[model samples]
Target: MSAFTESALLKKLSELNTSQQSIQTLSLWLIHHRKHHTIIVQTWQRELQNVAEPKKLTFMYLANDVIQNSKKKGPEYGKEFSNVLPKVFAHIGESCKSDKLLGSLGRILNIWQERGVYDAKTIADYRGRLHKESSSSAAGAAGAHPVAATGNGNGNGTTKTPSDKHSKVTDKSEKREKRKHEERLSKSKRSRTSHHATAATPIVEPAAPAAEPENGHTPPYLPLGEPPEPEELIKALNSIENSASSDALVRERIAKLPPEISEISCISKLEDKEKAKLLANQVNEAVDLLNDYNARLAAEMEQRTKLAAMLRDFQAEQKELLAQAEQRLDEHKKKLAKMLGLQKEIHDHLSNLPDLTQLPDVTGGLAPLPSAGDLFNTLH
Candidate 1:
């Protein structure tokens, strides 16, 4: 062991009333630290060769603890005293140094602070490089597209096909294509009318307005032209849904209009009292919708709860089954052990009997031993 490691071990031994096993373990650990320190010195001697001062101080601090703990027991612990003191002196001799060790520790601290030890300039540099590469990649991608030169379509950096480019080049070509497609579609549609048109009825356009009365007044009850096509109706609904502020402005304007003026407007023709009644009806409808939604949500939650409970019950049943299987396995093992013991006992009994063939030979051998010469020798 290095002097530093031996000293540390001695100090540790002094601190605690450790058992023999603990002492042995600590000795092994000390040897390991010495080996580690040797490796560290080999790699970092230039940087850390002068770190003896800090290491000495650290050792002293550890030693103090040991000495203090030793004082707690009476001085009659001679073996502990003998074992610790020589190691301590040896450690001090080997590791104690002044300027070199202190300077080394200061340099290490400065380097540690500057470098952040874990991740300082290295991380920042990596991040900067990554960002630069990403921006370059994005610019390259943007440059790859001819469409990027013009702000058409979705403005994504992608090239367009010649046909797609032609479509965008002039409205005349697009209109012509649309008209041709419509003509072809119309022909096919007329041919397959019975099959295709059966899914939905054909919409009938409203007739143009007839000449007004002699006073030039239009009828108040004219329909708004067949209530728009389904696609148009859907688009109108989407626009209304998307334009909440516009909807609110419209509603506000309707609400502020005079009764006669409101009555002239199609959407705001009702009196205040009638509007209030309509609003109350709407609120009631919303409440009913909310209640229905909540009821469905509650039913889903109850189903989830039931499923969780069933899962928990299944887990408990599985655990019980596993425990029963284990119990059965243990019982079988015990029975097998008992049967083995009985078999062993039976074998022992059978092996203890003498062979019948050996009995006569045994009797003859005993008779020859009773001869006169053998008897005289036996008497002596």
Candidate 2:
């Protein structure tokens, strides 16, 4: 039988024993022989299968050694076999620790060593071989040793040594120079386009001087003076009212008069004593209007401030409510997930039960109902 099948059978036998000590002893023997042998034979078979010629022959010789040693030890020896199992296991493990098989067994032994099943020295040896193989494979891929048959070299038909570092540096410098050249070209193109656009646009000059005023006609400047008597001013204002343009011009001329003249012109048609009384009444009315307007403005501003504060408060409350709503939604989703999980568990439990629809009713076999006196006696 193959080593794999033999190992599986031994494992099964060890599982059959119930005593802790017996199980341990049997397990130790099985592990030393079948378990270790299975690993070595599998490793040898894989390595030898791909090689041609002498390498294959070497693998066969190694495999033969393991098989012969296992046979000489005898298969299926009982408790007496335990005495020599460790030494044989160690020898087989060392044979498999070669660089050829290290990759396959390195990680495996490291795990075993971590679990206290293998020694530290064996684990380190296997790991070291794996590292060496990785480095060698990397060197081969990088074309470190070019063969004469491949003809990979300089154009002059001479084989060249690898210089990866120099090639990498040259590539980087070329990329940087290319980028800088592209930037300079782009900036020059932008500047040329802007200059052409400016040259194409039309420039507008200022308009010619306005036509000179005719006949040296200068506008008459009003002279500041005391206002005319009320009766005279009233007559003058009435005469100008007939012409719209003359009336506007007259009003403008009057505004340039002294402040006292302006006030007198406002009340020009009234008598002196009557005008004084009217002026006092007008002052009181203006004061009342100003006070009322100020009061209304203050109230409106206070209302606006209150409304703005209320709006801010409402926005804060809305945010709180939204947060509460999100929390509730999360809680509901959790509850729904839990309910679904519970429903699935219930469904599985019911599915396992026998079909109750096909069963006969046994309710008729139940004892008859007792009276109140029987119930009292049973309780007593």
Candidate 3:
């Protein structure tokens, strides 16, 4: 088992086929990471919801494989799947009325019941939602994987159209001729005009995949946009010390300001003509300094708040990178282990074989059979 990401799981699900190898391999991975049963089931449900009707049965086949196989090892996957299966059944049962699908569903339900994959009540619920009466040989018919009805999943790895998934491959020229004929019928009653118009319209080729980023360029983050570094942020915060909040002398000046400058109740202190002018000058200067400082403080506050948001984004991007790296590391380790296992298997098999010297001496043994190449080595 390797690090399991939801995206990897979704990719695996999207590429899934009806082959026992495909289903069982994915099943084993899911069961190994059964602690993520919640996410696995949720991803499964989402995939089933998103696929075309024809391909939907493969998703169901996946669910059946995981549910039936995950039992005995741990019931977590089966239990988690149980929560969403009714909805899955309803979603699948409505769109898929294929007799093949119905028969498979019935057989699956029967297998589940016989194996006690789910409790009696749950079994009843599934039967009510998806079971269909079919021949008892469904298990035999389906062979190993329940989705054998799918023939070969998408046959040639192309996506299946909305029609039956098991349909035989149609000739491309036949389809093209039929489409052209339909176009002629739908046009102004002249066949030549329709033929000319259709001939003039070029077939649109499928678009090519986007080119990979050149010169080692890629997004700075797993998601778009990077945030300022801690060093840059610290510099920005230090620059904000020009603010009143960080200015001890400015705070002291504010504290020492006379009340007569701002208080109407203390206007009696400014009764003299010259003294009144002095008081007005004092008030004007204080107001100018305070107003300028207040504006700077507001701007600083806004900048600091934005910086906090950037910090949050920076942390999120870091976590995303770490998670991606961890997943890759686990996958690498798993591959390495598998390689070592294969190497050991090869060594063990070779050790079990008799070397050339260990053969029965061949002293009295019958002469070995000659090869066809040996006869040809001599003159004919």
Candidate 4:
């Protein structure tokens, strides 16, 4: 691991901005030096505490990016950050008046829970600290509670002494007022529900925010293996010619090995020393050729083993992609079916309507109008 220095870390944190590029660049560096995760997290917490309030949210984004992207490599960063995140949340909550920033924190916390980044209890603890801090800040902003802060008749923060009879009357008045408030709320709720159920217009949903690239550039695809085509694999396989099995000429020569080299009796029967030496030399040459061919075969076998392993990995990733594709296909099919059903409903509703063109005209006297419920409530 490279040397870990607090100054160096502090420098990077100081240079950090709210941009995605800045956050991602820092996260990449942090993950690269993840061996020093404990120290990194400590330094991060210290910087967050000391940094100006406005930059605290930026620091939070950096932590989130690091913790999430580093999961596959190791869990050290996540664990260390989790230990400090409660304090980080509280600090941000105290200093941050922006509901948007606190909501982002809550969203990050939810993502952690969903992704199994932290256990339920740890997340709960973090959430509690966040809630407590947010609640205190909100209360402080809104000023103190009325009952405690308001004085009795005097400006001093003290309650006015009242007789028991007056106290009873005041309590009854408050209860009656509360009851009336509840009744109004109940009636409003019922009216809203009935209006919603009978509404004729289609409810339009809010437009979702446009998607942004991860690094403010091209979006990254998932790590699904993009294996080469079968033709490409075939060409590659054909290009590998390191072994005797790939050479027909070498195979033919091996098939025709002389008995002089193949048989022990043939070598022993040679009586002349020169002849024996010559035979030995010839055998040695043949042996060298075979050994060289065997070495080539060994190298070729190693290559083949590697190719096999690569193909296995590629296939596994392809299968995962295939499963995801199938799921998407199912969802799209369901959506298509729903759309078709909606079209049919529209046609049927139109057919049920009384055509104004075909209606009998009453020029001298007006005809009674059709009941509105009969037109709309037909779908019910």
Candidate 5:
């Protein structure tokens, strides 16, 4: 189990039969394997989503067991458990949150604190959400935790607590205040810079450029009206390629432009028209490259799919061959036993037969019952 890699564990889990026993086996395997907690949790969570109700329940129970077990390992293990809690909660979703679930989470957090690992932000967020849900669903507008406003030390509110609404409002106001503070700070800095610049030097202005198109859109790099020179097109491609904000899609569109430019630039005395044709050729080459990439990707995916199928088939064939071999060995043993018995019977019959010497010589010339060795030589 300690030697099991993430990929190996995932493959093992995928090959297992869908049964309660297998689920438990996987759970125990996970518990025993302490490394790759993140990978293990992700794989389990994904599989848990598509599983049946019984399996889902089993996984939930397994997660709880892991958490409980981690408690005994002390704080170091508890931190691992704490890291796993978020993924489990995400898998369970809002529907699975209960007092028991919260209590379990709370216990893990407490363990973490005891072990000297003390960040409970995730649990606190979950607890807040849980309280909100409980308050909304209950028959009375009762708060689950705080009923101090009702003048009772015990936490049982008959009416909706203003605290819940107040908290939401406070959060929004805090955000607004923070944003305003940042804006004020930025303005003050700008004002200070302007004051220093005004004292040091005079501000100069530059002429405005020509107006843009009526629609505020620029024409394409190679306009439809006329063919552009190869140099201009290559320059445009370089600008697009080197621009920081250019996305993958844009880069892909001009992928082959650079190489084409280099190749064309190396040739002497080429006409603009010829260069334009080469540019088109390069565009087609880029498209072909893209198609090839896609084809290779598809082929690799198909190979993987076929390999998995072949592996399963090979395992099945191996089992069948082993069973057949066992059966054949059993048949051989039975035949050997039967042959031994027949040989013993023949020996006994030969020994029981009366010696030919004791019989009044049936054939006068025949050697007396030819000793066993002489009979073998005569037969050969």
Candidate 6:
């Protein structure tokens, strides 16, 4: 919400035909002016701390996108993002003011610049200014002390004290020491590059000058070799995952490259230690991928096991039902047999009783029929 958020700047910059002059100037100024960076980073951290989840993410995303775009497109690429750079800087400048916040900003900027997002001239100018400012501040602080600037309180002393002279000498000494350190770094980088050049298969382009690191020392990268960029590495891994097939060719390709080169695409400003760390992370990522694959396999196995158990239960239930049906069928068969036997017995009994009617009917039929008729005739 701070004025540095640069909503207007971001909006205007997002257009196709916005002025580049303002963007170039402002970006350069922001990068070059150490005090402004300090203020901006401090403000940024403070705001980030207080901001809610999605909103905080928005701020981070904006910053990251601006830097990433610049890295991909060039330093002047910020002109394309509307007011993003301005918004980010303004917001940070307005809100953050802690050393911790400043450190965070420094790390973010270092990564961006290292990624080739920053303008060379802008960074050079900024460093020049910083050197000058540091020198001047040290001198001013040493000279402005009441005891150091003035002789005694009596105000009559004319000669400079030893302590005052020592301060000036100390500043010069410090400057010389810094120069020596830079020389050593340059020599070390040269040696490393020469060593790598022997095994280098591809003709690599020279790396651009890197920004000073967090420790105030610039560490040079070893020359580029035949390896994919970090983005490419991740992309390859993702493709492998999405395809759901572990391609042996891809694994072979990754395995052939040294850990340093296989894990990252760009190592322009990375020190050997940083490169090692990145490699370690890549290893860890690979391990995680393997673990995920194993977990999926286990889950599939577990599902199959469940299905098999269900099938077995279903078969057992069917067998029990079949047995019960067979038992009922047997009981019906036995009852059918008994009913047939009873019918047979009844038939036999009726057959045997029928003969008696024929035999007894002869005598009974002859006597009974005539007697009634004769008596009636006589009475008439």
Top lDDT prediction, candidate number: 4
* Better by lDDT, candidate 6 or 2: 6
Put down candidate 3 lDDT per residue, 172-249, tens digits, no spaces: 322443444345334423533343335433222111111123377531111112345678768876776665578888
- How well is each residue in 155-236 modelled by candidate 2, as lDDT tens digits? 6554544434333333344345345444544665565445333533222111111111237743111111112334644554
Top of the candidates by TM-score:
4
Query: What lDDT does candidate 4 reach at residue 287?
Result: 96
* Higher-scoring candidate on lDDT, 2 or 4: 4
lDDT-based ranking: 4, 3, 5, 6, 2, 1
| Model 2 Cα shift for residue 142 (angstroms) | 76
- Collision pairs in model 2: none
List per-prediction Cα lDDT, in the order shown.
Answer: 0.39, 0.42, 0.61, 0.64, 0.49, 0.44
Residues 50-157, model 5: lDDT tens digits: 765434544544554344434433334346645655655554444443333333334333333433444567555544553444345442345365345456333553
Clashes per candidate (backbone, < 3 Å):
1, 0, 0, 0, 0, 21
Listed in order, each prediction's TM-score against the native is 0.18, 0.24, 0.35, 0.39, 0.26, 0.24
Compared with the true structure, what per-residue lDDT tens digits does model 6 show for residues 163-192?
A: 445445544544554454456557756654
Name the weakest run of 10 consecutive residues (lDDT summed) in model 2. Answer: 203-212
Per-residue lDDT of model 4, residues 143-258, tens digit only? 54344455443566634333323434433543554454446446655654454446433222211111124456542211112234566566657757545458878777777878
lDDT value for model 2: 0.42
Clashes of 1: 1
Model 1's TM-score against the true structure: 0.18
Model 3: which ten-residue window has the lowest total lDDT? 202-211
Q: What digit string (tens of lDDT, one per residue) describes model 1 on residues 1-380?
A: 22344445445534432222232333333323433433322322222223344444333222222222223233222234234434443333334333322222222222323334324553333223322333344456556655654655456655545434332333343244345444644654454444332433222221112112336543211111111224544554454443433445545644554443223353464557887686557556555655565455444443343333344434443454465578678988999999999999999998998877765566445544377988899899
Off by over 4 Å in 5: 1-24, 52-54, 70-77, 90-380
